[model samples]
Target: MNRALFQKIIFAWFEKHGRVLPWRVKNHEDAQRMSGVRETLATYFTKAWRRDPYRVIVSELMLQQTQVDRVLPKFEHFIKRWPTVLDLSRAKLSEVMIEWQGLGYNRRARFLHEMAKRVVEKYNGVFPQTETELRTLPGIGEYTARAVLAFAYGQDIGVIDTNIKRIFARVELGVEANAIPISPKEFQSFIDFSVPKHHGDPWNQALMDFGALVCTAKSPKCDHCPAKTLCIAQRIAEEYRVKTYAEFLKTPHRNQQKKQSIPFEQTNRYFRGRIVDKLRESPIHMEELRMHMETNHGLSSRKKFGEIIESLVLDKLIYIRGSRASLD
Candidate 1:
């Protein structure tokens, strides 16, 4: 597809079908400036939306390995509670962890808290606009660093997450994403070249919304996809619509094992989360925790459960003093 035409189609679809997310909301100035642009609706809508860097970091950390629907409420509550980086920096780790209930990933809360403190102390509560500076912060990885640059500062860069990689694999590489693994970094150069500097903000948002709502990872709505005409993997995706998850895994192109593993309830991560959930209510004795684990997670014996507790303490997620353990 022609790069300009691809952008045109995608940008138009975005104006029509873009998601209404709280974190994506534009500030008063952006809204006012956007409202005054009389060149063309496409020109107006194509511009990147400006956002508070604080909200962007909060939403980005909360959305990791979690669904949008799940993050929506939690993000709102968290922002209301600690409206800025300075506020979050002042909060205790234990208080942050407690507010992180139902978010599953306790470590994310810690990272967010630590990142806020660094931003407050080092940068004086202002997020650096450059990717190099942002990466030094806790929990700020490659994708996150660039995402902050693009979404928060409207930098002329693409934010390549899994959804964008899937879109690239099918639309540009002529293969279903499930047929092989897709790495966001592999296509970073292509996306950066393709991304229009003026519309970098809405452009990345459009691609993400397109992937989530239309060209999804499973059972993609190819027939209804606005980019189907340009997508090379449309027919390939349609061909596999009848296959079950097991069948997809068993296929030679899948590059995955078909055998099942232990249930999530039996995993150490699940038990760790269980222990965290218990600690959230209040501090408890080690024996009581053992009994709680036995009653809830079906662990009747220690079986390295003690090791998990010590590990959590070592990770700074919890603190241990004598027989009692609690969130650090």
Candidate 2:
């Protein structure tokens, strides 16, 4: 696709049907009554929350493989607790982990903690601005580093995540709606060239929202979709598949007959049980903690349990007073 044509299609789609999110303040009615939607989106895209690298990094990290709804509360609480990289650096590692309890993938909490320390110690409590510098930090990868630079620093570097990947795969690769391909660096280049001038941040975010709500992983509502005319997947569905959208809508999801979800057991889960077990036992020395693990408990090894205890200690769930360990 040509750059100007791509921009016209995407921007047209975004202007007419872009989902309004709470974070998008430019569209707020109080801001301006007569602003064009495209201009409002562009203003929101450029001027919105591009100052703090830590905020950008934290939000991105919290969002990793997690849905926006699940991440919102956790992200808010984290920012409230830490406020800044400096605050997070001064905080106990245990405190950070405790705050991170419900987020799952506990390793991210550890990485954030270490990243905070590194920032404070090495970077004078300020997050690195460039993508290269940010990438050198613990837990910061290419995607995350680029996200920080683009979202926080207002850099024009291209960012392509899962949502953008799905859109690009369908549009460029002529893939089926259900069979989106993985994103390649070539796709990044395509986006860099095709992205609306001076609208990289909001444009990327809009693409994400578009994929999530309209061009969904399952059962996309192509008729309502902004990119319907230009979409390869929709064209394929029309040409190759005999079923109309109305008829397709009548079909139940393939796994609809399966259980809606796996049972979420609070008590039987390993960590919850371990916390209970630790509380029941009398205060034990670190050495005694190791011995108990080896003798009575069928735990993998004392070393492993010790590491858990250490994490628990850092998280402030457990603490050692003198040589004995107990719940905090």
Candidate 3:
């Protein structure tokens, strides 16, 4: 359960049964030829293949309020479209929203676009190298900034996402297997002392993947867990496997809860569609577009339509045309 034993177990298990992901590998032709990978996934198990700072920033932004699997396709689509920070900075806000479709919680798209603008204007379209500088960007939180600094730029700092938080919480605190309450300060402490000095990036990845695959939320495979003995939850399991804090707590269920479904033919949908349709055609005056949305789309109020329009604007699916509106 000591640090040395914990590190030994986890590192050994990592060498044996680690998952292979595309982003983990270096794909450059020279790197590939030297690394003996099939031109696509050299260094597939290490941190020598993380994306650049800009891509890391984009991926982190997209990942907020969204799952990794869901973010992957959208990430690919976004990379194809923008390809670079300057490209994104110049892209129409509305077009970015359209590209961001299906990622729900549309506000993130707004932050991303704004962040890109700031990057272009201030950082000369290059991501900041230090965590402090990176965190100064729009919508870049501490965790995200640290992640970019560590994973992308290879800075030696601890980065804690949900997965790493869970692993450390259980391993250190004897909390429930899947229900650990993680705090930023405590997680930072773990990161400061847990990860090996030279291999901070891979060690972080190992923790993330270990939490995801071995120490999963619902049911953990403790028998094969690398840090099992170090894990407080496993110690609890050793004494009483199926009994923990989360198990005994009981709560009421508000069953049969349902949303008052908005009708498809409602003005909201119509106005939204019309806004998109018009934007597609060309930019229009904001006042004139508002009138169309209110009258033709049966909108209840200008304010309501305006809010929707604003949301669309933030999503970057539409553009403002000479103080008016346009589709991107």
Candidate 4:
């Protein structure tokens, strides 16, 4: 494949359609003019926006296992409340968890808090620039480390998120979707090779935007895709559509059923969220907790509730004091 040509096509599409997210840095000169600041474009983009590692850290952590749409408001609120690593490090974990409500996966909130403390205490409030140094922090994995390097440090590194992985699987390997347990090392090599030199940040961002808006997991917009002619998955999907249509003509009544989702109210996660939400307001007795659960959520299993409370306490998410339960 002509990698340069591919990069050109992707970048051209991105220039027209790249997402305007709050975390993304805007045009430096325009922003400076608007703000009436007398700083150079280099200083504004490098120092004020892209180079601010704190913003990258917070956004990347929140984006993990969460959708961008759901994260937008929470991210804005979080950054507004705790604008710096020192602010976050000094905050109570319970307060962090309270702000982290509705974003589920409460463990991430704790991890972010711990990461902030580590950055403040060990690094003296300076965010690490290298991937190796970043990996030493709590919950900093390979993907996140590389992301910080590319986005914040302007390093020519490969960032292999789920979307980028899927794009590679389809465009390079001719697969409809990436299979489970993809080999990270092999895929990383492909991405590192394909990423244009000196254009790592925009290249990675464009690929991500294309994957999210055009080449989605469930239903890709193949007709509107810029790389349709070059994409093997598009051809494969076309063939599959024709075959499926023929089969449907033969057996129109045998349509496949959609999978059913488990009820949220019946889930342990739901109850855990309820427990945390309740405690966010005030500490309550176990009896009162049970009553609220029963009355509000229609959950009547006292034994199950007790088990969940015990589990939360063990996880250090909650504290129990003389039959009263509160956030840890």
> Total clashing residue pairs per candidate?
0, 2, 7, 0
> Comparing 1 and 4 by lDDT, which wins?
1
- Give the per-residue lDDT of model 3 (tens digit) for 1-328: 3777877777677666666543443322333344544422224444363556767777778877888789878886787678678889999999999999999877888888988999999989778887788778888888888888777766666787877777776777655424333334434654556767666667777777787788777666776665655777566544543443233122111011112223455634456677898777777888878777667777767677766676566556787767688766
- Clash pairs of candidate 1? none
Cα deviation of 9 in candidate 4 (Å)? 1.2
Best by lDDT: 1
The residue-by-residue lDDT of candidate 4 on 1-328, one tens digit each, is 5677888899888877777665664332343344544333233224423546777777888899899999999987897788778999999999999999988888889989999999999999988888899999888898888988888777877798888888877776555343422345535655777878777777888899999987776666766677876775555445545333213223422222111223567666678778899999999998999899989987798877886686567557899999888886
**TM-score to native of every candidate shown:** 0.66, 0.63, 0.65, 0.66
Question: Any runs in candidate 1 off by more than 4 Å, and if so which?
Answer: 27-48, 178-186, 235-328
Query: Which pairs clash (backbone N, Cα, C closer than 3 Å) in model 2?
Result: 94-314, 94-315
- Model 1 agreement with the true structure over 1-328: per-residue lDDT tens digits: 5678889888888887778776775543443454445333344364456678888888898898789999999987898788788889999999999999998889999999999999999999889888889999998998888888888788878788888878887787555555433233324655776788666778898889888887777767765667777765554434566233323433664442312333667655677789999999999999999999999888775855875675566557788888998886
Distance (Å) between predicted and true CA of 39, model 3? 8.1
Give the alpha-carbon lDDT of every model: 0.75, 0.64, 0.67, 0.74
* Candidate 4 wrongly placed segments (more than 4 Å): 26-49, 180-182, 236-328
Judged by whole-model lDDT over C-alpha atoms, candidate 1 comes out at 0.75
Error of 4 at 70 (Å): 1.0
Worst 10 residues of 2 by lDDT: 259-268
